[model samples]
Target: MALLHRAELRPSKLELLVPWLPGRPWFAGEAGAEVTRVAAYRFDDPAGEVGVETLLVRAGDGPVLQVPLTYRGAPLAGADEHLVGVIEHSVLGRRWAYDACGDPVYPPLLAAAVLADAGQAEEYFEVDGKREMRPASMTLTGSRTGRPVPTGPVSAGPVDSGGTVVRVGEVELAVVRQPVPADVPPAGGLTGTWPGQDEPVLLAYAR
Candidate 1:
């Protein structure tokens, strides 16, 4: 479960992403188009120190683009090259955002979602000393197509904004950056549903 706060974010996620999206080689969205959030989902950090989020956005009428991010109070050592940007959180103070594919916390969790059937974290709103379950902007479902359970440390290979493949002990999980209708979603991955979307779309797959 993840706790949420109704606080302001300076240079919001979209603000940060718009400037960075066009630089990515895999960015297929229209150039110079305005970006807007479509939906988002979170995965919890067992230690409760890092914030894990996978955001979906669209530029103009272009296809949805996926951006996985991790937030930390302090810079992650040895990950300076992967830094997304810095932002100020009303309650959390300064936050360092990084590309989730480079964050050490992401691969294992993603692998679990693909192999162990781990789903998105449950979120709660925290304000005025009261807690209430917050409705998800989107829902996530993990599926494993009869693959053997995962084992050992998880590590992600070269990441492609188009699709990322992370290697677990013996299984390889392919995370889809854009849910296209043409590509067939393979077994053993994750799917998601959000407002205005008629059907659950494949978010990742394992083979």
Candidate 2:
């Protein structure tokens, strides 16, 4: 389960992504186009220290883009290159967000989700010391049967229009940074759907 806080974020997520997305080789939008968040999902960290979430955004009429992000109380050691930017949290003070592809926590948890056919984590908000369910903005599903891959440090390769390959332990996972066209081959791993979408959209796959 993931806890949701009713906190304010300075330079909200959309603000951060607007500038960051265009720099990514896989980003399909115009460099300075307006970006809007379409949907989002999350994964729970067993230790409850890191915040794991993936956002699907669209720029104008462009295809939806998948961007996974990790939030930490402090900078992740050895991952300066992946830092998206720092944000001031109303309740937590400050947070450092990084590209999930470069954060060590994301790959293994994603691998476990794919191999175990797990759905996105359940979210709850604290109210008077009691937890109440908070509906997620997106629905995510993983494949039911796949070989369990050990999770480990992730090394991200150069991203291109096609996608990027990251080595997670001994497993190689391919993240589809851009939306897959209708004629494209079916995704082989986790998928998601949002309001008004009847079909599951590919998020990532194990290679």
Candidate 3:
């Protein structure tokens, strides 16, 4: 389960994304655009050391964007290029956030999600030392040909079609940074669907 804390965050996630978005080649937002969170989902780290979450945000009426992030207690070694900045969490203290594609923990978990058809982990909140379950807003579906384990460091290529290729060893996982029309062919990697959506949104695919 993904545990959430009802604590304050300095320079909230949205605040960090505002400036960060413009620097991304795949971002289609206008300068000073307003962004709102539409939905989100989380993947549990088996070791419980990393916090993995994917945010779906809309920028000034533009298409929804997918931003997968990984929260780590300590800086991820050799991931300076992917750092999204640090933030102070009321409950967790300071955290280093990085683009999930560049983290070693993310690709393997993503592979498991796709190949095993794993659902997003259930969310929970801790109150007075008690845990309460919370509903997840999105569902993820994965392809059948995914490898069970990640083999090497991740390398990202240029963005295209609102997506980017994240290479983990021999596997190329297409990380979709924006939502496209449902009519787009599903090449079979990772897809997600949320409430009020007419069709499944493709998030990633293995090539």
Q: Give Cα distance to truth, residue 90, candidate 1, Å.
A: 1.2
Higher-TM-score candidate among 1 and 2? 2
Report the Cα lDDT for candidate 3.
0.80
- Listed in order, each prediction's TM-score against the native is 0.90, 0.91, 0.90
* Model 3: number of backbone collisions: 2
Q: Candidate 3's residue-wise lDDT over 78-98, tens digit each?
A: 999899989899999999999
Instruction: Give candidate 3 misplaced runs (Cα > 4 Å).
Output: 146-153, 182-187
Off by over 4 Å in 1: 145-151, 181-187
Q: Write the per-residue lDDT of candidate 1 for residues 97-130, one digit (tens) a residue.
A: 9988878888778877866678888899976788
User: Model 3, poorest ten-residue lDDT window?
Assistant: 180-189
TM-score of 1: 0.90
User: What C-alpha lDDT values do all the predictions have?
Assistant: 0.81, 0.81, 0.80
Q: In candidate 2, residue 102 scores what lDDT?
A: 90
Candidate 3 TM-score over all chains jointly: 0.90
TM-score attained by model 2 = 0.91
